[model samples]
Target chain A: MALAIKELLAVLKDKKGRIVLIMPPILQLFLFGYAASFDLNDIPVAVYNQDQGADSRELVARVIGSPHFHLYADIDHEQQISSLINNKNVLIVLHLGPNFSANLAKGPGTSAQVIIDGRNSNTALLVQGYLSTIVSDFNVDWAKRNGKPPPLASLKLRAWFNSNMVSRWFIVPGIVGLLTFIITTIVTSLSVAREREAGTFDQLLVTPMRPVEILIGKSFPGVLIGSLEGSFILLMAIYWFDIPLRGSLGALYIGMFLFILSAVGIGLMISSLAVTQQQGMLGAFLFMVPAVILSGFATPIANMPQVVQWLTYADPLRYFLIILRGVFLEGDNSSILMHYYWPMAVIAIVTLSLAAWLFRHRMN
Target chain B: MSPFAKRFMRLRGLIRKESLQILRDPSSIAIAFVMPVVLLLLFGYGVSLDAKDIRLALVVEQPDAQTSSLTSAFHHSTYFKSITFHTIQPAERALVTHVVDGIVWLRSDFSARLLNHGDAPIGVFVNGVDANQARITQGYIQGVWQTWLQAYARQQGHDLAIPVRLEPRIWFNAAVRSTDFLVPGLIALIMTLTGAMLTSMVVAREWERGTMEALMVTPIRIWEITVGKLLPYFILGMGGMLLSVAMALWLFNVPLRGSFLVLSLASALYMMVALGMGLLISTVARSQFVAGQIALVATFLPAFILSGFIFEISSMPAPVQVMTHLIPARYFVAILQTVFMAGDIWPVLLTNAAALLVMMVIFLGLARHKTRKRLD
Candidate 1:
């Protein structure tokens, strides 16, 4: 415990260490919260209305009025689509053929044509969904005004857990896990490596501390610091971002403790193997980039191939992310999250034991 | 010998020494070579935004021929894999337990209401923890429901005519494969690694080891020092960029629609900008560790998050969107995506290339000024 306190204070007392600990996570939280959104707001759309008709104007007005699309330009000719899409001056073009009103009055044989810049497929798909929603609404309203039967059964759509469906609520909790992972890994990875580089490993060994005691001493600071930062970010997420803590706090901390243990295990493994601080930093990076990407933090894991899915089971971040979303959105309790808890626990056990063995082996 | 020849000879010697130093370091070689392939394979294979094979639970209160057809429609869809339940309670339980991502509830009056009233609405409950996946799932569900409704309408011998059906023409990328865009954008990210992380540590490591003072004891000028430091990493960055492009082409199957010459020019310009930023960071930081941390936070994190490499810039809040203009990777990403996805459109290429040129000049200018001051 004394060695742990000394190690923690050594990091906390250093100016660069304090800066690294305090500044990046806060910046990452704000940056990720504000910047990383999949919701396409103010999608630039050009309207090419060849039909000077009332029905076409009504639909155009609906699109322009909706918050989803911003009116970029109203072009009159056929040659403008390529320039608008190619220059990226607009994301989508809403083109109404001269026979737009005629076809609407006659039947449903393609009245309006939408030309989209499909550079980003996800954005293009979302744009299609938005336009389709508007067109379907117009069709339903037109059918009612003309005294015809409703076209089809409409869907009563409800998004559970997040009614507004803002991306910040989803991303902020994730930043908690991500920032903590980055900090703990870098700190613990550099700890023993820094000592070894300064030729103080021999001095540390000459003390009365056993290798197990030394290992626990080294990891305690990482765990304590990780938990403190994780709690602070959690509070910031709950209050500052206004994201609710829907699940029990006990479940969240248990998950956090297990996650930190596993991360420390991984870091100690890297630290023990590294003879220099550079190698430690590089090793931390090699593990970190994959952990974040494969964790399904930004993208979906289910979308990956079958072989990749098997790899995800070994990544502790994957399970922790599931538990995080479960607690924040699903209102899952500790008992409810037992399945996630055990995998992280098993990971911690395996990694911690391996790190302890590596630590003692490296002492020789 | 002329003074110009002497300066050129000195610069070449410095460049050769820096080159040898990099070649001798295994970590530098690993970072410049192995890390690129690792990052490329990971981004190409591991990441995908397209949501598919969603697990859905279908609750049918009354089993009928129409209900069977509806359940079959869910099963037939490329988007959904569905399981049938007799009631809503178990389906809701499945949703909570994450055994299912969504639940579709059809009450007992489904067939009666569909045949008689034609206005019965089905309830859809989606897990909204992942807002992106939830949104896409919602769109897919609507598509399946609409297609099914039309098929059912045609079966009843009446046409459900709609006004203004959308005929969509998806330009640039018709198949909507994300790898085409992501692989190109990843070039910017990989270049960032070569530029900021590698170069940022060069001068700092020298300073930490007291080698910079030894080098300064020679007659090497600040500009020569800057050039010698940057030239090797610039080559490494471009080599990494080329390897990434090759992988994007042969391994990932992303198209290079633009001319190779244009791609090379843009990559070279972007590499100079990256190397300049790394040089500037190393000049300011006195140690390799501090330089690495700064580069990670300033260059790399911004390049990843704010560059529109994966997330859409239009979706970001106003201030963050404005801030993206300062990141050089944003322009590189724009140029690379256009070159790979859309063919050489001079407006996009020229405008983004101009932006990179301006940033390169600014960063290189700043590094030179900082280096000269340190020498003085």
Candidate 2:
């Protein structure tokens, strides 16, 4: 316990260490949480209504009135459409034809071109969906105000967990997993490598301390730092972001402790192999980039191919992310989260034992 | 030899020594050489935003021929893989538990209400844990319903009316393949990793090992030393960039529509900025751990998050959007996507290349200013 405390204090004593341990959780949480959003509201749109009729005017009004779109500038001619999109002044152009309402009144349908700037296809797809929903709603409202029945088939949509479908609720919880993994692995990997590079490894090894004690001393600081960072983000999630914590905090911390163990184990394993601190840092970074990519933090694992989906089963971050989201948003029970937790527990055991074995083997 | 030639010879010697050290360090070689390919394979193959085969639960309160036919319409869709629940309760539970991404509920009077009221409302309860997926899944479900209605109408010899026909023509990417755009943006990310994150540690390691103090005592100019140290990493970063381009073209089959000269010029400019940022961090940090942390916090995260690579910059809040203008990767990503997909559009390329050149000059000047003979 005393040795572990000493190791922890050494990390916290330095000014740079303090900044790395304390500053990033707050900075990244605020920056990434706000910046990473797919919900595009008030998307700038340019409208061109050549129709001099009331129906076309009402359609344009409905497009502007909806919270999803904002009227940037009205275009008078067809030549202005491409220019607006090219200049990125507008994401979509609503071009109402001269015979828009005339065709609606007649049997055949009228055409309105929603020309989207597909440079960012995700944004274009979402904009198209929003425009469609608004137009269909207006069509129903117009039909009902005329005392006629609405469309033949309608969909009553309900989005569970996030009713308004806010992107922050999903993104904020994910930062908890990502931030902890980054800090823990980077810190612990540097701990022993720093000593080794400074030539203090020989001095420390000469002392009466056993290999297991040294292993615990070196590795537990990472677990402690990881949990501290985890809690910091968790607090920010609940209070700063107002994302409620529905599950038991005890369950959340237990899962986090196990995750930190696995992360620290990986770091220690890297530290054991590295001859220099630079090597340790680079190894940690190389591991982290791929771990994050495969973890499904930004994209869904379901979308990955079948072989890659099978590969995700071995990633600790993938399982922990499932637990984090499940606990935070879905209020999942302990038994349900254990389905994810046991795999992390197994990883922790396997990696820590491997590190310990490597530590003992390197001692001679 | 003239003074300038002597300086050039000294810089070459320094570059050779640094290259040897990097080669001796297995981890450095792995990071500069092997890590890029591993990351590219993972990102190109493993990560995707395209949604397919969404798991859905279908709840039919009444089992009849028409309802069975409607459910079969859903099952036949390439987009959905569905499981059947007899009632709404189990399906609702499945949605909450995430056993399925969405649930479709047909009320007991679905057919009867369609005949009597000329309409029937189907309940679509989606798990919006991932809002983008939830939104896309909602569209797919609605499309399936519309198609089934059209087919049923055709079987009955009638036409279903869709009031305003929307013609959505996607430009730049005709098929809208996510990989085409993502692979280009990823090249920027890989360059950032190698140039900024990896280069910072090499200089900081010299400082930590006390070799930097010894070098300062030698007859090397600060600019010469800076250029010498940056030269090898620049080659490594460009090599990584070339590897990414090759993988993008051959492995991912993404077309390189623009001139190769344009792509290489933009990459070189962006890489200089990345290296300069790394050297600046090393000078300030003077410790490998701190330098690594600073490089990650200052360069890597910002490049990944603020570069408009994954998230659109226009959608970010006002201050964050302004902050993105400060990041050098934003320009690189723009140049890359433009060059890869839209071909050599001079306006986009020249504008972004000009921005990258300005940032390269700024960062390199800062790094040179920071490199001093005396150790603080």
Candidate 3:
């Protein structure tokens, strides 16, 4: 208990360490909240309407009026469309031909030429979906006014759990786990390595503390700091972001406890193996980047290849993220969450035991 | 000896010393060399935004030949992996438990309603945990429904009128492969890691070990030490960049649409900005632990999240969009994406390259201003 207090004081008493703890959590929470988004608001669009007909005018008006699109400037001719995309001035350019209304009225259906900048395929695909929806809406409205048969089999898409389908609710829950892992890993990994670098490892081994006592002392500070960090972020996620906590608070805290243990174990292992703080920091980062990528935080795990999918089983964040979304979104109880809990518990045990083994081995 | 010549030799000695230290450190080598290739492979093969094989449940209340045709459309699609349930309860359970991403329900009067009024609205309940994936999955479900309707309309000899046919021109990337897009932006991230992370940690280690005082007592200048420390890592960062571009081209098969010379010049400018940020961080943080965390907080995390590489800066909030302007990786990512994916459109490339240049000047200037031959 005395040793744990000393470890906590070493971190909290340092001016820079306090800044790292308080500033980054608040700053990163806001950064991930406002900045880390996939929504395209005010996507720049260029409009080129050649036909004077009312029907073509209606379609053009519909495209421009959409909340997803913001018209930069209207162009006059065909030759200028390439320049707009090349300049990176616009993501999409809507060009209507001179015979657009005539062809739709009497002749065959004409095409609405939408030139897209496909540099980022994800953005391109999303813009295509939004644009096509607008055109389909225009088509349905046009048919009703023209005394023609309406289109067959429309869809009524209703999103469950998240009614408005905000990406932050999905991301904030995961960020709680992500930020927890980063802080705890950095704190714990730097501790043993800092002592090793300062030549205090020999002094520590000479003390009356047993190996188990030393391990618990070292891990206690990290677990405490991680839980506090996780709680702060969780409160911010609930109140500031207005994300609902649908499930029991007991289940979320249970996951948070197990997750912090797994994180501390991984950090302690890295700290024990590293000769200096630099190696510890690097190893922590090396583990973290892969863990995050494989965790399905930004991208989906199901989209990965089969061999890679098998690797995600070892990442503690993967199971923790499932628990996060399930509890917050699906209102999952402990019974349903037991499947995610045991894997993390097993990881904690395996990693902590490995850390202890590494500690004993390093004594020689 | 001339004063200039003496200064030049001392600088050369410092440079050699810095180079050897970096080469001797295994962790530096690991971070500089191994991390990039590992991240490249992960981003190349593992990280993908393209949604496929979305698990969907088909709830058909009254199974008929018409409903079978509709369910078959989902099974045939590469985008969805589907199973049929007799009632809505089982399908809803699958959705709640994450066994399925979405559910498509076919009502009892499916054919009768379609045959009479033409207003047939099918219910699609989607899991909105991942809104982007949810939208894509919902779009796929809608597509299956529309195609089946078009086929059904043909059988009944009624024209399902789609007023405007969409002619989409997907420029630059015809295959729509995300690897072609992501690998270039990843190079920006790797450069930041190699340049900023290494320089900050090494410099702060010197400060923590009291080596800076020893060097300060020598006649050699601080700027020379700064240049010496930065030069080796600049070369290493450039090497990592080259390896990344090669892997991106051969291993990932991403096309380089622009000139190689332009990419190199832009990378050099961006490397300087990263190194300067590192030096600036090391000046404030006297310990390796603080330096590492500060470098990550200042340079790397911003590069990962705020840069246009992974997330669109334009889609961000107004204040955050303004914040991206300060992040050097954003400009580099813009240039990289333009050069690799879109051809060397001089307007986009030159504009972003200029931003990197201005940022390089400011960061290097701030770093030099902060360093003095004295202990605080």
Candidate 4:
């Protein structure tokens, strides 16, 4: 054990090895914290108060008042509003009716319309929330002015899974997927590339280690490291970010283990095909981008076109995401375990087998 | 001989070398062409906003006509395909236990109240944790409610006042295909990968192989060497640009409304900036590993994420928005989108072109300074 530790320390002492182990996780953490944000804020908003009355003006004020919104322009004409949205100058347009104040004065049943650009649905949804809150507040104020008891109609929103809507809740679990992609894919790619660069890859082929053994040995460290990073991030998410881990710990780990295996397999495949480290890196990126996007992390798989949705069935990250969201948020273990376990298992076998085949072919 | 002619000759040699290198690597060439197409297909088919097969629990407090009518709406809507109608208690239990996404509470005297008031507010209890999904569900529910309201208003001998009607004409992407949005960004990403990653490593690899030292002993001037190294990548970048454009047109069918001339000019300018960035990174990073890493972080990530390709840059926090300005892809993506979808918006095109030119000059200047031969 002591000899192993000494050898490991010696390996780590190399600047390249130390940087290889440390920099990816640290840089990834930086990206997770600063770059990845789903909570839409400061979304450009354009307003056209056709009413130009007290109600219209008040509506405008309410929109501008919210921290989530930034009023870019207050246009007079509807055409200008359309042009702005089309130009991508604004994400939302607030068109107040001519009878805005009159409707408010009349009472509780009155309604106002909000037009949103749904090109980016996530931002549009947040904008809609802001719009609803403003309307609800307006309803409250109008009730107070009329000296009538606040309308009996009330909407009590009960947010399930993540009640606070802290992005960390979703992002931290997704990081398991993201980290697996970044670390396993990048590390394995670099390992294969490094061996090639040093002319040691050819030397290794004549040794006792079979192609499968070599591929496994090179990829296993990355999978272990990826899972470790995932666990560390998950811990930070729970302790620091206050994201709840509602599901069974055993189930989450199992899911994570499978996810790492598939991810590492993908990395190994890219590395085998690449002649140089740079090719490996670029090839890894080519795979990683599509994998991440199609993982249903940034967008919903169900909402994708039918063909796209069917394609997601092959994406291991898709199953992993479902498992992550299920176990972490809902604490529902049975359905996820039963449904996703087989898919993950299948992916692991398929990817690992392909990687081994590719590795042997490349070596030959 | 004129300096221009001599520089041109060196550049031509460099271009030839770069082309040969690219042709030799089948994997990189395959990735350069197929990866974008794969991404577009995946994004187009796999990522969607319309939710289906949502697990819903309908809670009917009373066994009445209004409750039945409301429950029927839930059943009828294609968005909520799988629903389990249960008592309020069971529905609430299911919600907390994560079995169902939402529970609809139907009040007592629902039918009578509806008849008297013409319309009644139905309580919709949504799990707000998945805000985007919740919002989409809420919109679908609201549409159902509006249809009911219209019917109720007509029965009451009232013409429902249509206040604000927005005829949303989604230009460029009439279908608002996410693939359309993604394809343009993919073009930017591919160019960055080829121009920055491939170019940066090539020069650094030459240095590592000791070929650079051998070349240094030749009559080739430092400027000639630098320009020569850049020339092949410039053409390679253009080739990547053509591949992306062809994919966008043939595969994704994204409309190119802007002039091809403008697209070519902007792409050429953007390629220079991308190539210049690669040269600078290669000059700074002595090793292939470091050069690749630097290129990935500085160019690839920013191009994909911060370039308004996948995420909206305008919606990002002030600091991030400011940082995005430094990413060359942001300017290029804007130019491409404008050129492709909205036709030639000259002012936007000109401003972006100017930014790319500035970035190119700065990157080339830095590359020149870094790659200058030094006497110890």
lDDT of candidate 2 at residue A355, scale 0 to 100: 77
Cα distance off (Å), candidate 3, residue B211: 0.7
The alpha-carbon deviation from the true structure for residue B44 of candidate 3, after best TM-score superposition, in angstroms, is 1.0
Number of the top-ranking candidate, with lDDT as the measure: 3
**Top-scoring candidate (DockQ):** 3
Q: Model 4: clashing residue pairs?
A: A159-B128, A160-B127, A160-B128, A303-B48, A304-B48, A308-B45, A308-B46, B15-B232
Give a tens-digit lDDT track for model 4, residues B1-376.
Answer: 8987877776677667767877887655765566656765665556555467676787666767555655676788777854555467778787766577787776665566666643345677777656567766665665555565555556568754433222333345545455666666667877887788778877778777878778778667777787777776677678768877887888778778889999999888888888888888877776777777777777877787788776667657678889888999999998887787778877778888899999999998888787774412
- The CA lDDT at B80 in model 3 is 93
**Per-residue lDDT of candidate 2, residues A151-265 (tens digit):** 5667898898888898888888999999999989987988877787778877878889887888899987898888887888888899988886787777787788889989998
Best by TM-score: 3
Instruction: Give candidate 3's TM-score.
Output: 0.98
Pairs of residues at least 3 apart in sequence or in different chains that clash in candidate 1 = none
Q: Which DockQ-derived CAPRI band holds candidate 4?
A: acceptable
Could you tell me every candidate's TM-score relative to the true structure? 0.97, 0.96, 0.98, 0.85
Q: In model 2, which runs have C-alpha deviations exceeding 4 angstroms? A: A146-149, A202-208, B373-376
DockQ, all models? 0.74, 0.69, 0.77, 0.33
Model 2 lDDT tens row, B34-108: 887887788888887778899999999998877887899999998899999989988888887778999999999
**lDDT computed for candidate 3:** 0.88
